[model samples]
Target: MSIKILTILTLLVPTLSAFSQEKMVSVNGVNYHVLTTSLEQRKPSQPVLVFENGMGMGLGNWNTITDSLANDAPVFLYDRQGVEKSEMVYQQPTPQKIAANLKLLLKELKIEPPYILVGHSMGGIYVRAFAGYYPNDIAGLVFVDPADFTETKADWNQIFRTIGVSEKQIDEMLIKRLYTPLKVDSSRYAAWSEGQVLTDLRKTDFAELSSLPIPQVPILFFVGGKLEVPMERRSKDYDHERFFEVKNSSNMLRWRRFIHASSKGGALIYLSNSGHFVHRDDAAIVIGNIRMMLKAMEK
Candidate 1:
């Protein structure tokens, strides 16, 4: 195991990389890449936890949080068909279709009802629709710095521009920083179809969540109180306007407030030390809050 030999092997087999334990689950001849683990350690009555990933994110982005909690429940993760390991078929999938597909996936796998739905960013949008469409099946909800229409591309882009990023640079950044880590082919992100699916779904999902009656289930919305923008990048591109005027950006503070009103007990937590990826930024807080919500449900 000499250094030279190791270096030679690495160069010769650039594609040689370790992969996680996973499998494909098919529903109606459509195959989906599913990564399931941790049920063995689950308590008999514990509700299954299903993760709905954010736009341009895959199961890998959740490793930091899921790895620790996987043993605590039957945790399920999958690609939204065509985004990553899952084969792509749907084009600009609607919110209802997304919700239906997830329900089907769960049904075929026998994951059953009373699920704890955890969603981040735009993933929260789909989770909202799922709860609305199948309120009886959902037990609880955990939203990590969830996104909604209150904050628009204009708001986000202005922030980027303030940080001195050109439109082209922003596109590249989204592909590299947001999508690439998920194993998404960069071209798909750049394409019209790939971007439109989430964009249209966001509008549809947001409307669905807004129009629905308040949920009776336990719901917890976590907001990253203060956004932490990259200082080096911000400084280099500083125009002195503002780096992240995102204090009022999250749905917790605005449009999605009804979620907190879902129940007198529904809660909203602002994590001052965290950012968009709240679970990754402060898993302890997220886990602690979830445990607290579960405990509350008993009463």
Candidate 2:
């Protein structure tokens, strides 16, 4: 199962605080919590930085990164339905639907595009869906250890097999690893429920967009290193050291392919000190690359 991402919007502004003045944007009766810096408005042509959160995460996850991005460009951050102050209705939404809702929210807020989308984890997939659905609106993309939806199960199986891991071992590791805190809270939390549904139906719901060619935009990927199961979480079902090696190599290869396939190809920065949350682990790197993308788009 895979989770989708949350959305954020940025503008040319000063530093931001965690608890800033947030607007409750109403789109089709469901209210969304939108947190944006109060900066002098720029022209519509200037690309705004839109940050999306990983699966089962909220806009707060970006606090460290977004705070440093101050005064560079506009940043937009918002909670999707069922998260934070945002209200969720009963229906389950696909990535396209979530993107559509995001589009509507931007419109309601009067924020114009030529957007530089920054997505972490599952948010990467949502941003990709947005680019696929509204290609013209995107100016660039920054993926922070995004979920690899393009890879097939067979591909991973081969990776495990090469390390002398049996099929049963692979299955056990996956089952255990997939049982995250989000899964535990899904029955009680609306956000977790939506996240679970999105993850479960990711292949089916994201099939169309994922099948589309990679968007021809200035793209950047912030891939992490140090892929290992935590000591407390490690089990005898799989070899933790081997899994770490395979995960790191496999993800790097995939991201490289993505960068090469992009029309206006971008750079792939690997942070050895970082884990899955690259932005959180190495804030300086993420901020610098985002600045680079913004400057490139300006040209």
Candidate 3:
């Protein structure tokens, strides 16, 4: 290529990229980084897909998953408050406040109603709360190894101990690895550690949700077959099922029961070849399932 043409192309690329940078929104004094894919392509009658990341995970992890889904419809994802580029939030909020922020985000973004909410890990709880709070607005729900309120304090410790992670190790890892790179001050880390973040995330009022009339929306549960548990970290009775199981039972009987009781359509798929991060572990499964959902909605 000619020198003039090459120079022009290089200059145009960064300019185009700058136009595609992620957006930042402040709702109720909390700043957050958000990415909305293809709002222009979204149909007025169709529901938009909103993705909620697992605990400590940022929107960066959803690149492939969101892109694949965005091919058919709009997709949304955002970094949680105080994490990543969200302006380093320090004050912790309750579950209700988090859910309220999500509702507000959707309103301010002007995302069309009837959302297909997809959540992973603790995010599942948040989405569930969102669905419960605004049942009419949510068209479908997808849970990927979601955390539950059923897990007692003892259950949390036992499961962690069984997998060889002490509370101290968790605290140290968060400080040395997660916070250190962020250059977060010691006081903030101290405050975040006080609740053992995961422990705090598990404190949900699912019982009331379970007791309420089930929402008439489609639900999908993708059970990850692969686990990240190191052989040395697990006990002699180690099994991947136990590690990824949302409840105490290896068969996920609780989830199965919920499905059986629900009036809405639901499916249980075991991603035998994939692990917790099903988007990357088996994009085909996640994509195919989403396509199936899209097809069903067409009817």
Give the top-scoring candidate (TM-score).
2
- By lDDT, the candidates rank as 2, 1, 3
Cα lDDT, all candidates: 0.66, 0.74, 0.65
Scored by lDDT, model 2 comes in at 0.74
Candidate 2 residue-wise lDDT, 184-237, digit = tens: 454446556556655554435346666766778878988888764668887565
Each prediction's total of clashing residue pairs, residues at least 3 apart in sequence or on different chains, is 1, 12, 1
Overlapping backbone residue pairs in candidate 1 total 1
TM-score of each: 0.71, 0.84, 0.74
Native-to-model Cα distance after best TM-score fit, residue 171 in candidate 3, in Å: 22
Q: In candidate 1, which residue pairs clash? A: 82-88
The predicted structure with the larger TM-score, 1 or 2, is 2
Clashes of 3: 1
Instruction: Give the alpha carbon lDDT tens digit for every residue of 61-127 in model 3.
Output: 8766766677776778887776566655555544465677788888877876889988887677677
Off by over 4 Å in 1: 1-21, 40-45, 149-186, 189-194, 201-205, 228-243, 246-250
1-299: candidate 1 lDDT, tens digit per residue: 11110011111211122223376766655667777665444565678778988876777778777765654566788787666766667455555777888988888666787788999977787787787788888888877777653444454555676556789976765455334434444366523343564554343434555575555777788887665655554545334325445434434456356554656456778787787888888888888777776666556
In candidate 1, position 238 carries an lDDT of: 39
Q: Which parts of model 3 have CA positions greater than 4 angstroms off?
A: 1-21, 149-213, 236-251
Ranking by TM-score: 2, 3, 1
